[model samples]
Structure formats: C-alpha cells, structure tokens
Target: MSVSSRPDGRRNHPLSRPVDVLERRVRIGIVTVAVLGVPLAGAAAGGAAYEHDRAVAEAQRDQWRRTAAVVVSEVTPGMSRGDLAGDGKAGTAQVRWTAPDGRPATGVAPVPPDADPGDRTHIWVDRQGRVATAPLNDTGVWAGSLAVGVLGAATAAVAGVAAVAGVHCLCEHRRDRAWEREWDAVEPEWSRRPHQGG
Candidate 1:
C-alpha cells in the first residue's frame, strides 16, 4: 500500500490504521510479559521459595534424630482408605525408644498393620523426644521448587493471553462502532435519488 494525503491535507500512511496500531501495541505488551517476563519472574520466585524450604529442612534435620523403637501394642488397620492406603494398611502402636537425653520415652506412632508387640522399627524424634516426621530430602526440595515454578509460569501466561484477548475484543467493538457512525453519515448522500419534481 502507498501513503497518501488525508482529506485534511495531512499524510496518512497505509499502515497507520488506528485500530491496527492500538492492537499491535497491546500485543507487544502481552508478548513481552507472557513470553519474556513470566518465566523469569517465576524462576526467581520459585528459587526463593525453594531456598527457604531447603533451609527449614536443614534445620529440622539438625534438630531431629532417628532411633529404634520397640512396639509395645499390637498394630491394627488404620482408618484411611482408597489410593492412600499406605503399605496397603497402617496402624497406631505405642512404642518405647531411648531419647536424646538417654532416658526411655514412650509415644504412639504409626506402624505397618502387621507389626506385632516387641517388633522394632525406626522412628524420628525431635530433641524433646516427640515423634516427628523425617525432614525433606534434597530431591523433594527440588521437586517442590520445580512444581511452584511451573505453576507460576503457567498462571502468568494464561493471564497475559486473557488480557490480550480482552483488549482485542474491545478494539473490535470500538472499530465496529466507528464504522457504523461513518456509514450513518455517508449513507444519506450515497443513497440520494434524483429530484423528479424539478
């Protein structure tokens, strides 16, 4: 297309349609954020969260210890069902173990359903001798971090696409309204008939 002078004597480039220009600007913003900004931001945020979780896990590991405990009560099937049936079953049993302070401690802990009294099992306990879960390992931390990062990136991308689509719809609506107005103004002159009573 070639550039030509407008009716007001100003030059109008063939590519200078108002709707197209606005749409291009909107697309640029969306692409910049969705394609460029989102992933970087997600990585940073995920890294920070991962670091925090790792530090906590490290601290927990330092503050806790594993010990052998002897079951003092018969283990029975746990109440949980469905896909989470751990070991295909679970049980609560009273157990006895040597605490960090060298004294015997007793607590209720989860055990395999087949565990009998006097059966020995490994258990984690805090410094205060309370039963606790094991600390997250390095692999777990990395997996968690990756999941967060992916979720963040996906959410940002979706938001950006939705925003661009919304802008496009608005632009189309405005363009259509402008066309209707122009047509209303021109239709009378364009459709005028020759006078027959002259």
Candidate 2:
C-alpha cells in the first residue's frame, strides 16, 4: 500500500509532543533568566553608583563648608544669582551677587575668619570688601538631577527586561502549539503500527 494509504497516517501522537514542549520551556526559561538578570545587575550597579556620588558630593560640600564663607554683597532687581567656585589661585572668594536694581555682579573678596560658606551663603564679604559669587541654592538642583538620572536609568532597564520576558513568553507559546501539532500527527500511527509484532 502507498504510504498515505497505510493504516498509520502522518498524524503525530500527543505523547510525543512533550519533547517539543519541554524544549520550548527550556528555551523560554533561559531567555527569561537572561532578560531579568541583566537589568537586575544594572539596577544594583546604578544604586552603587548613586551612593558613591552622594558620598562624594557630601564630602565636597562638607569641605566647602569648612574652607569657604557665604557673603551677600548686595541684591539687585532682575539680577540672576548663581554659585561661583573659588578662583583656585587666589585666597580671594568669588561669588555671584545681585544688586537691588536686579543687576548681576561678580564679587571677589579676601576670605574672612568665622565665616561659613554653607550657611547664609547669600552674604559674602571680606575685610577687604564684599564680593559676589553664584548662589548656593543650585546644590539641591544638582542633587535632584543625579537622583532623576539614576531613577530613569533603572526604569529603562526594568522596562527592557519586561519586554524581553514578554517576547520570550510569546515565542514559547507558539512553539508549544507547534510541538502539539507535530505530536498529534505522530501519535495515532503508533498503536496500529506493527511494533516488532508485539
């Protein structure tokens, strides 16, 4: 008889389908592990980096508090205020000052004893004269920026992992279905076929 006319058709058996299902499960598991692992590792690393950055910033701010003083030269209308770093070469303090008229001014003055830059930084004056430096208020902005950056990165990483997992699940489901079909085609022939005449 022709192969098609045989009692056993090409239809697979359900029992044999498990192999394909198992293979798909293994593949999906592997992909899921990889997808989830990478982001978790990145998040851990980001946390560490954030901590390191915070520590460093705190240390720097503390040092600035000890060595520098805040002095408000004068306030001006429409004047933009900002923070100014020490010139590094001069003992003179550099600060951004705003005039009552709202005008911007840069002031440089000799460091004063008993002056703390961390407190009331709006006011900066030296025995020589008052100087203007940028406003110290921007520290909060900088800190916020750092936090936002870390959080954003972490969110992106988690989203990416989720997407990968979703794709893996979809592919596994399709594979499982295909495997079932394959097995269904093979199963019926088994019982009718001559199995060593047993």
Candidate 3:
C-alpha cells in the first residue's frame, strides 16, 4: 500500500488515491495497538483489583467470626411471604448466645429458614460483638476482579474500533474533496466545444 502511494501510482491508478495510503496505515496502527494494548490493560486492571479485594477480604475476615446461636422466635414472625422457602438457608430471627467472655448475649441473627424456637444455627459477629453478615469470600473477590477486567477490555475494544472508523471516514472525505477540487478546475474547459476555442 505504501509503495502505491508514490506519484506514479497516485496520478495513474484508479484505486491508489494519496489519502488511501494514510488511511490504511492509520488503520493498521490502530488495530495493532488495540490488539496489544487492550489485553494488557485488562490484565493490569484485574491484577490490581484482585490485590485490593484480597487485602479487604483479609482484613474483614480478621475482624469477623462465626458462632452458634439459638432461635428464640419463629423465623416467619417478622418476615413476609416466601422469605423462607424451606431451602434451609439463613433467615432473620432473634437469637441467644454466649459472648466470647462467657456472658449471655442475644441479638437478631441469621438462622436456618426452617428453624423453630430452640433450634441452633451458626451466625457471624463483627468485632464489636454485633450480629453481622459474613465477610467477603475468595470467590467474590475473584469474580469482582474478573468482571472489572472484562469490562475494561470490552470498553477499550469499542473505543479502538470507533477510532479506526473515524480515521477512515476522515480519509475518505479528504480524497473525495481533492477529486472534487480537481474536477471543479477542469470542468469549464472540458465542457467547451472545439470550435469555441475551448
């Protein structure tokens, strides 16, 4: 393509417009960068996200703990319809338990959906001894990192394609305007008749 951009081909070849070579080169450069840069950016994003999330997860796990508690009320007394579909997963309830210091303690906790009064269930507690949701697990950290990476790569890919297309459109406009200017300069004389000394 570069070889055909010389004056010989620019003036004689129907397809070798001067603007075409620049457009092709720009397109190739854009594609090359996209191919190499997007994945690199994604990997960098994913790695950074993973490291950040992993640190957060470690800190959260260090400050939370799982313990045994007993349900003191019906799981459905404070819940609406279908909140406990009997899948046996955790459901909100008031519970009784002994704190790490052996003093009796009670708070709202998550227990088995099918739990009744006196049923034991495991629950998590925060550093200050309040019932809390479990901390971030490894799976959640990995999933978040993967999502960030994928979204970053996808957005960059779209931007790259748009840039190449934009360059191509600009080149096409330049070539067409050049042809139009040449035609404008020659149209009058070409339209004149031979007897009119055109």
In model 3, the runs with Cα more than 4 Å from the true position are: 1-14, 73-90, 96-109, 189-198
lDDT tens digits, residue span 1-198, model 2: 222222554444454445444555566675676566655655665566666656755554543322233444332322223233432232334455554444555565544333344334434432233343322334543555456556756666576567656656776797778777766766667766533321
| Every candidate's lDDT | 0.78, 0.49, 0.77
lDDT of 1 at 68: 95
TM-score of each: 0.72, 0.32, 0.72
lDDT for each residue of candidate 1 in 14-120, tens digit (9 for 90 to 100)? 85668867797789988987888798868976898799889988897899887899999977567322212134456778899998889999988767677899999
lDDT of residue 2 for candidate 3? 29
Regions of candidate 2 where Cα sits further than 4 Å from its true position: 1-136, 193-198
In model 2, the Cα lDDT at residue 134 comes to 27
